[model samples]
Target chain A: TQLLEQSPQFLSIQEGENLTVYCNSSSVFSSLQWYRQEPGEGPVLLVTVVTGGEVKKLKRLTFQFGDARKDSSLHITAAQPGDTGLYLCAGSVGTSGSRLTFGEGTQLTVNP
Target chain B: DAGITQSPRHKVTETGTPVTLRCHQTENHRYMYWYRQDPGHGLRLIHYSYGVKDTDKGEVSDGYSVSRSKTEDFLLTLESATSSQTSVYFCAIARGLAGGGETQYFGPGTRLLVL
Candidate 1:
């Protein structure tokens, strides 16, 4: 089983601040995905990184996959109150469509 | 978003009782998953089905079982409900992502409490 360790388990910052969360693992992954979950709702996919050393951006947010394919990072710039949520990183070896193994999660709180 | 519905969105059952949670997807997705969410544990997969009648266990599969008789429905059963099982349960359907592997679309989630 692949274990993903997420750093900065809880972070709180004022609006307009910048923050970065990391996901690291000892096992290589075929794909890694980032998801955000709001209170009372299931998680929503933010981005998927399949290639090592790849960088993908969604407005104000950037996701990077490590060169070794064993880690990833999510950076948020100019965060807003709406950006406060639970951020989860899931990795899959994809050897039989194995269900993703999730990180402990980083809880972000952006205050206005 | 694929139309996914989980029955008994809120359930309160007694320990040692059998409880079933149903997940229905209108998109006929090939993959469906059942996961449990806890405070520190995040979300852990309980079971997953690749296709009709084809299912497999995940990292945390004990005390839970799943069945998929049709492509549109996946059922998760707790043979005997326990306090450890009281948590928000989420069902997700996996569909191909534009660039790679698969992306999962989740339901609103079902909250269960075992006393």
Candidate 2:
């Protein structure tokens, strides 16, 4: 099984600050996905990166996949209090039916 | 918000008791998954179904079993609940895609407490 290791397990920042969370793995994956989960609710898919060195932006959030397909990162610009949540990175290998391997997650807290 | 719902949103039970959790989706997706979320452990897949009556175990499948009789419903059961099983459970549905690009929509999740 592939294992994803997330850095900065916990982060606390004031509103308007910027932060980046990293997800690293020794194994290569076909795709990498980012999800943000709020308290008391399940995770919601934020984005999927299928190509190496790919970068996608969602408003103030930016996601990037490593050129080696063994790492990914999520960067939030001008973070707001609403951005606080648990961020998870999942890697998928092989075909679509393959299961995803998830990282422990990064708990982000953007204080007002 | 993919029309997925989990029954018994909050459950409290004792050890050695049998417990069942239900996941129902209205989107008629082809795949469904059951996962458990624990502190510092992230979400670990327990079981997944690709089609009706076709199921497979995941990374953390011990002590749990799943059954799917219809495209919209997946059931997960714990034969004998244990304290280690206390955690929030989530159900997800996805329309399978190639190259593992499919996005999974999750339900609200069910919080289970085992005493």
Candidate 3:
């Protein structure tokens, strides 16, 4: 089983502060994705990095896939209260439609 | 926005009873998956299907069974409900859209409380 471990399980920061969440794994993946989930709602995909050392930026958020494809990072710039939610990273292995293994998640709390 | 919907958004059931959760999709995607999330366990895969009548066990397949009789529907059944089975259940679908982020879309989720 592929496991993705996330760090700083819980984060509390004031609005406008920047934050970065990490997802580490021992197994390689074909692609890595980032998602933001709010309470009572399903997760919404933020970005997907398919190539090793690939980087994708979505407005205020930047996503990076490690060169080895075994890890990834999500950096939120000028974090706002709207960013407070559960951040999860999922990795796709082999085929494009293969099952994705997700990280435990990082709960971000941006205090306004 | 994966056009996925999970029924029985919230349910409470007694132990040793059968419970089935339904996931419906309108996107016509070929892949569907079921997962459960706990406080510290993030989301763990229960089962998934690649095509109609083609299914496989996920990491946490024990005590759970799933069926995909049609391309649009997936059913997850709890053979015998247990308290430890209490968690938020999510149904996801893969779009595989070109240039679209290769991420899964989740349903609103079903909150099941087992006694």
Candidate 1 accuracy as TM-score: 0.97
Cα displacement (Å) at residue B47, model 3: 0.5
Tens-place lDDT per residue, model 3, B26-91, is 989888999999998899999999889989999899999999999999999999999999999999
For residue A17, model 1's alpha carbon misses the true position, in angstroms, by 0.7
- Clashing residue pairs in candidate 2 are none
Model 1 regions more than 4 Å off: none
The Cα local distance difference test for each model comes to 0.93, 0.92, 0.91
> What would the per-residue lDDT of candidate 3 be over residues A1-112, giving only the tens digit for each residue?
8899998799999999999999999999988888889999888888879889999889999999999999999999999998999999998886556788889999999999
Judging by TM-score against the true structure, name the best candidate.
1
Clashing pairs in 3: none
- In angstroms, the error of model 3 at A106 is 0.5
Once fitted onto the true fold, the runs of candidate 2 whose alpha carbons sit more than 4 angstroms away are B96-100
CAPRI tier of model 1: medium
Per-residue alpha-carbon lDDT of model 2 for A21-81, expressed as tens digits? Answer: 9999999998888999999998999998989999999999999999999999999999999
DockQ of each: 0.67, 0.71, 0.66
TM per prediction:
0.97, 0.96, 0.96
